[model samples]
Target: MLRLSQFIFKETRERLGTLSFLINSIKFVTLAVFRILKGLFMNGTKVFNKEKIMQQNNTYVLIMAGGVGSRFWPKSRNHFPKQFIDILGTGQSLLQMTYARFLQICPKENIYILSNQDYKGLVMAQLDGIAASNILLEPSRNNTAPCIAYATYKILQQNPEANIVVAPSDHLILKETAFLDKITQALEYTSKNEALLTLGISPTRPDTGYGYIHFEQEAVAGVHEVNRFMEKPVLKKAKEYLASGDYLWNAGIFIWSAKSIQKAFQTHAPEIAKLFEQGNSVYNTSEELGFIQENYPNSPNISIDYAILEKATNVFTIPADIGWSDLGTWASLHEVLPKDASNNSKSTDHLHLEATSNCIIHLPSGKAAVIKGLDDFIIVDDEKVLLIYPKSSEQEIKSVAGAMVATYGKEYL
Candidate 1:
């Protein structure tokens, strides 16, 4: 009986030892995995914190929203331009979208809208979150140079070491992530260098509406030196540009340090620069408006492209593949929107009786529109004015809008 009992005790001790070994093995593996995952998580958090600091410290956006969008005729007007309206059926206006895109890369307080004084109310109403002071209003439409000068001087007064991105308020970027990434990279590049950088879109077709930028094929740290800037070219020149493999569509988006641009203006456009520099004392104060009104007209009515970019020797180009469109015309808007099986795009549902091939219509929802046997046409109904025009003759819209305004008064416009 004693021997049997001893044998049982020995077997039990052996089984307990095996269980202890199994538990220790599992505990060791789990601890190793947890440490590895914890290290990865901490590293990722460190990277994110660094990026956040980089954006907050050095980034500011200057959105130019002062244009009278005549090309968008019945939909866009002088009082309420395309930037304030939802040109896309996406429920957000172009200005709002542009604002939102920058929020991902910078603080909301850092974004400023440079718009006409007439549209101040519209800008305030659309972007309620922005400070009224941040909406830099122009007394009259002198052009981009004055607009940029005012914003730059004001921003410089606030933060001397600011890196600014000047972008049009009405452009559409289909790939928002890639757009922000490129802009982030640009801000980083401009922060450290005295170079002036502009985002250039790779040309997908021979588009005559856009200006062209010829760049050196060799790139320095992912940026190319600008060979030359060409105005909107004729069809033959545009086609040649497409074939050259060295040109990109100028996106009208620019990035530079506030100090760099201020210096450029001092060197190349000293007259305009001096006008704003004199207002340095009143820049971020209550006397700014009076100063701007007194001095804005003295500056030349020239675009920033002609004013500073063309003359600056340190200009560089970052060729970006982000899907972009200015959406200057109805035809361009149609290209971005989704079409039905019949290749007809519309903002509202409408009946199609044998209507086929590349037609766009904009009408209020529940409004009845019957389109038949039309191809490559544009139909817009804004309740007061209805425009049924051919897409091929879209360029005539500016003249047509002017004529209508002249004949029917500004109410129709």
Candidate 2:
């Protein structure tokens, strides 16, 4: 009887030991699976979080290309502005070059072109791969204030935290690296601070064509708090400004957060702000075309500089030594272009004989051009018209084109 009882006790102990081992193995497998899943989930969350951060800090560049570049006429016409011309012989248009420059800082998706509705096809043809939806078209010419406000409203709708850089389409920059660096710094500064930043080129000469920004106090890292804004000054005043060393030429490159600019428009140009606000409700909707056609032309026509920058107290200027030119006139173009031995700029087919110095000749192929002993003259030939004038008369070219259009019914314009 005692031996049978001992055998039963041993068997029961062995069964309990087996059950303990099985339970330990099951717990080990379950813990291993849980750990693998947890690691995967954490890694996924990290990747998603990083992507979110990048998207949040991303910038949007708005290129204002709607100007009728009547100054560069004969070569630049109403059908195609200077921005679409390969004036530099670089195989890329000015607009393309500008887009490429900004691509270093912003993605293509974030870059936008605010242009005339008529130029939509031109823009699409030039920028083939870019999405068409990104291009914002203006119904009519309402000047810079409305254009900027509309672009700001649209961008803010997409990304409320968007840092926007508004740039002209036809400015010439010789120092691209320095220009891009200044732009990046401005964007970073404006995003972090609630300041309205405008890149002002360090005035190398007394250029009366550009507006000036007077620096109030000592500069902060090559940037200055703007004391006041000056429109195009007279020659003597411009010389004085250059000598003062506290002035910078307004380059028309502005950087500000969407919120900051919106507030500026609200405070200074409330009419433009309301127009855009109304237009935004119809953007991307079926009624977009009708909405703009009805409302855009009625908006007040004013420059952002006059409407906001000239009046705003929170304006700042970044002094950039970047080689800058507005390229507003033929004389300015000659200043930037390479000159020949006789100090003359001529296209490939232009023939210059006895042309001593200070002349620009631009003639198309199959056209004959001759300049004899002329100083500071501009000679341009297009398919429809030919222009020969002194370089000092650069400002009158626009009027000439307008007169030609009036007389010839738009054929010679």
Candidate 3:
């Protein structure tokens, strides 16, 4: 009886030990699975948060290159505008260079070209690497205001939170790094503040060719609150502006969010804004051409400066010393181009004799050009015709081209 009782006790002890071992193994596997799942979930959350942050920083740049550049005539014709020419001998067209500069700040898909419908092929050929859908073509030449409004509406449709930098395609910027830095700063400010921002170039001369921005006080670091906009004042007024040190050359570069610009249009130019709103449905579609052709001509021919900036209360200016030139006329081109020892600016192929002071000779092609006993003159050869005018009369070149187009056929233009 004693032996049988001992055997039963030993068997019960063995069964209990086996049960304890099975419970321990199950607990270990459950804990391991929970830890692995937690780790995977945390990593996925981190990656998703990073991607969202990157997307919020995205920006768009709209380049206005639609004008015919009638001022740079003889060389700059209707079919081939100044923006498509290699005026700086940099082996890249103006549009190409402008697009490349913005690529450093924004993605290629975010860059847009608002140009004439006629120059669509030229723009595409020059900027072939950019996506074809990004280019916005105008069916007619209404002016800057309509062009900007259309672009703003289209951009807002794509990205409601988009910030845009609108720039001209033909201007020459020497200090690219400084220019880009200034643009980035302006974008940051505009995104945060509800203001219309324009980059004003530091005035180096009392020239009457460009517009001026009058500031009452410095708003921020290197930025000023614009008091008023003065357009091409007289020589006396220009000197006074220079002496007062409260003015800057309007560089015509603007940075603002899509919402801000759209609001400005709605407030200042309601008719044009309505046109754009009605035409927005056709954007990025084959019907864009037909819609613009039908609706664009009825819009106003006002500039953004005249339509909104001049009247806006929240206008601000960033006075940038970013080495800028509009290249508006022959004299301005001479100012930016390198001069020889005799203080004369000559193109790739030119011969000068006894030309000691202040002259600009530009032959578009590398054809031999010869000049003698001339000073302060602009000589431009466009293969079909040549222009010889005084550098002092540079502002009259556009009027001269218009008169020629009227008198002769478009062949001479």
Candidate 4:
């Protein structure tokens, strides 16, 4: 054993110079010491506050993915929405990516999906290991307020003390580590405080697409009190808010305890809250779907912003620099994807000779395209339909899709 150790040491010395070997040895020792300290620290966490840790362990995540993604037109259809397709060229779909992102902080069984009942099979096909019971299938489209209330009541049935994060399944997050860290901090803060916390993305530009959150000057526990919630403003107002340096782009991501949000609804949105509250005995049971189908559509169609956040006094905001995008439009997708020399983003293999500034996108199993002269246009080819329009006219695509469905049939939609 002594001879073997000597041989090994001699080989290591030969592979590395004298000083290099010593530095490597020091690094190894330092890493070992860090591991030991980390183990001790983690063990000590269990002793500090057992109940707090247990409550945190009950963290739940709900992903809302009911939109049809009409803006993406030919690529995103009613049956197969953007969330189920890999719009970013990644192997996983957007819903799958959202589920995977939360898996870093929450257990698999704790993550739930709130989507349209028509797309229930698609949700199951995209996400693995998700129980059918965890999918909250909305009987009709009632917007975000009713969607969130139903999910809250459902989770409350399983775990009343559940701390939940409600996020859109179609959004893109570039920095997973930083996003998870921010979520962890928000969860820890909301677990103790009776606060409705929403993750606010620091605005890089005066984007008119998203709503803005007005943050107050005072802060508590690294969270800012919400002064007001602004609707999507014109470019002029957006620039004013941006220059004022007091607004954050509302990312539609929220975190709060089941109790806190329930109370908020009870106080501000009593009518909608009462609808779900009446189902307390039926929730988590077989009669849940029937109860939802009967009462969900009757509830007022409103957003969580309108029904609660705008009216609730205990709302808070967490300013985060995590790279985020709602991915709401083709133009937005072009911003997050890689571009060519002439500022073109393509999905399929293409040969662009004089096509200077254009986005040439194609779904799989269609056709390879060759372009010669085009500038600042969108060239997308789905299997059944191909769209060629100016980038400036991207906003009209949704209307075009509706027109197609009206003129032709629902098959193309």
Candidate 5:
């Protein structure tokens, strides 16, 4: 081992003699040896899978992945939504990434997925080791209120004192350590208090796509009371909210105790509460399917924000700078991805381009593409359908997808 280490240092120093180069070379060699040792001793287990804090078996995760992601059409289809796709070019899909992120907080068996019944096969194929029963299948896409109601009620049956974190399967969080730290903090707070907490991202821009959250100036235990929830506003209103310094981009990530949220539903969304309450005995049993199928659609179609958080006085916000993105549209994806000198982001290296700037291109592997004289545009070529549209008007892609479904067929979408 000493001989091998000396040989590496000698070769590195001979090739690059500068002081900085020698330091970097030593660091690289050290990292390589460390990785080898860790692989041998640890058997490739991840850093976050430690047993220290994950013993909080009362902590649970509910990943909401029911949306169609229509704005990212051609790539994100109805049958194959964004959550099941590796839109970031990462090996793991978004749903897999989300599940892995929560392994630091809770045990594998503690995690659950809230998704439409149609994506059952896709969800199972993407996420390994999750219980088939843990995948709470929604009979219909009744939005988030019904979705949360079912999961909250169901988890209550298994563990009446569970504290849960609800996150979207498709959102991207770049700063994992900080994000997890915030999650740990939120879980700590929720385990103790009756407050309903949402992780609010500090806005980097006046983004009009996301809903804005108005919060109080004071904080208790690093969380502030939410004054109100604002709808997606116009450009002028978004800019005003950004300038105010009292607003955050509502990230839709929520944290609460099972008992706290259950009570909120009973008080604010009584109908939804009563509807899901009937499944108390059947939540974790063989009768869950029959119970949900018959009763889920009867609940009102509403968002948790509108139904509970907006009305509940216990709503709180954790202002976090976690480098988050909803990845809602092609424009949003472009901003998060790496760009070239010309500011063009491409998923495939097979693209030949000239004078093309401020564009996002995604193509299947090994598919060569050549383009010229394009600016501020989205170019996505899924094997079946290709889309080329202006980045400024990317919001219209949802309507365009609906048009395609109307003209051609659902198969194309």
Candidate 6:
């Protein structure tokens, strides 16, 4: 009996020891996994959690569609801006494409378009199923500062902890996966810190048309501190900037918390901040239009860069190589559109050209045209109006459009 009891006791002890080892092994593996997950999320290497990272419930998007796109005229008119047209020939308007891109970042209800009150119908027609309230109409053309303030403050009222991505409606992004990743990175950083972050496109050329962002060696999780902002530079300065390697083209894509941006406005431009604050009570309500109509235009006319981004001390930028183009000019549009071996972009096959190189021809579908001996030109035919101008003189197109409006009538425009 004593031997049998010893045998049983030894067997029980060995089983307990094996069980202990298994538990310890499990605990070690779990700890390692937890740390790995924490590191991945902290470094922005991976997205976790449904609310913050996966579904992005707290993320909101603001699409700036108020611009008249005067540079793209005869094709882009005051009544019907370029944002509403299928400039890319992809059957999707720029506004529609922009809105669709944001949907992948946030909920459909969280998207907002800040456009002139005149374009509300166009906005609705393009973005079907979007809630009418989601369209934030600007009472007047007060530029970006006022509309941004209005939209940010209004979003704050709805979700005080909102993370907003402000983007132009007319830009084109070819590498969407890379672009979304950068936006997610910026959004993640803003969620944890009180930093105003913007994406800076790595410059591929010394182009003078884009604003440049100067960043310092200081960086946090891939975002660098912005040293200063430079407006469109001359060719010489642009080359210098490209050589320095510290400059990035300002993409105007910003990500920030509503609280953070609101604080910046309050700190830098108290008047603009106060102007929108008064309407907090009426925002998201039926009385909002009346309040905006009466008070929005009263706000100062200033760009967001001048109003807050330039003045804010906590500005940061993430250098990204995502294929981005503001599509600010016809020449810019030509660069991205599919081209032929001769370096010409034509929207329709009806256009037949001979000895033409470096030209862009846009015309209505099924409208046939034949041209010869033209190089580096823009030919656009939009019912009742035709524009054929040299690409080198495209910079003056804006003033030319205004002159046409004055000489002829707004009807032609």
Candidate 3 regions exceeding 4 Å error are: 1-57, 285-287, 349-352
lDDT of 4 by residue, 1-413 (tens): 22332344465568777778665632243233323333433442222232343346778888998989999888999889999988776566889989987877787788889999999999998887799988988888989999899989888988888999999999987656567767877888888899999999999999988999999867877799999999999999999999998999999999999999999999999998899999999998989989999999988899899899999999999998766889998888877554555666666443434645756455453355667677877777777888888878888999999898899999989
Model 6, span 100-173: residue lDDT tens: 87777788888889998899999999999988998888877888999999999888989898999999999987
User: What ranges in model 5 sit over 4 Å off?
Assistant: 1-53
Counting clashing residue pairs in each candidate, in order, gives 0, 0, 0, 1, 0, 0
Which residue runs of candidate 6 sit more than 4 Å off their true CA positions?
1-56
Give the alpha carbon lDDT tens digit for every residue of 203-237 in model 1: 99999999999999999778999988999999999
Model 3 lDDT tens row, 203-279: 98898888999987646755678899999999999999999999999988999889998998899889988999996
Who is ahead in TM-score, 1 or 5? 5
Q: lDDT of all the models against the reference? A: 0.82, 0.77, 0.78, 0.81, 0.83, 0.84
Per-residue lDDT value at 140 in model 3: 72
* Superior by TM-score: candidate 4 or candidate 5: 5
lDDT score for candidate 3 against the true structure:
0.78
Give candidates' CA RMSD values in order: 16.8, 24.0, 24.3, 10.8, 7.8, 17.7
Give lDDT for model 2. 0.77
223, model 1: CA deviation in Å?
0.5
Cα lDDT tens digits for candidate 2, 1-413: 12332343344447658666334332233233333333433442212122332455668889989987899987888788888876654556789878887777787898899899889998998886988877888888878988888778878877889999999988877666567667777777888888899998889889888999898767676567999988899999999999999899998999999999999999999888888898677676778678777888888888998899988999998888766788888888777554555667555533646846778777774466556778898888886788888888888999988988898887565
Q: Is candidate 5 or candidate 6 better by lDDT?
A: 6
Worst 10 residues of 6 by lDDT: 25-34
* Candidate 1 global CA lDDT score: 0.82
The collision pairs in model 2 are none
List TM-scores for all candidates, in order: 0.86, 0.83, 0.84, 0.85, 0.87, 0.87
Question: Stretches of candidate 2 above 4 Å error?
Answer: 1-57, 284-287, 349-352, 366-368
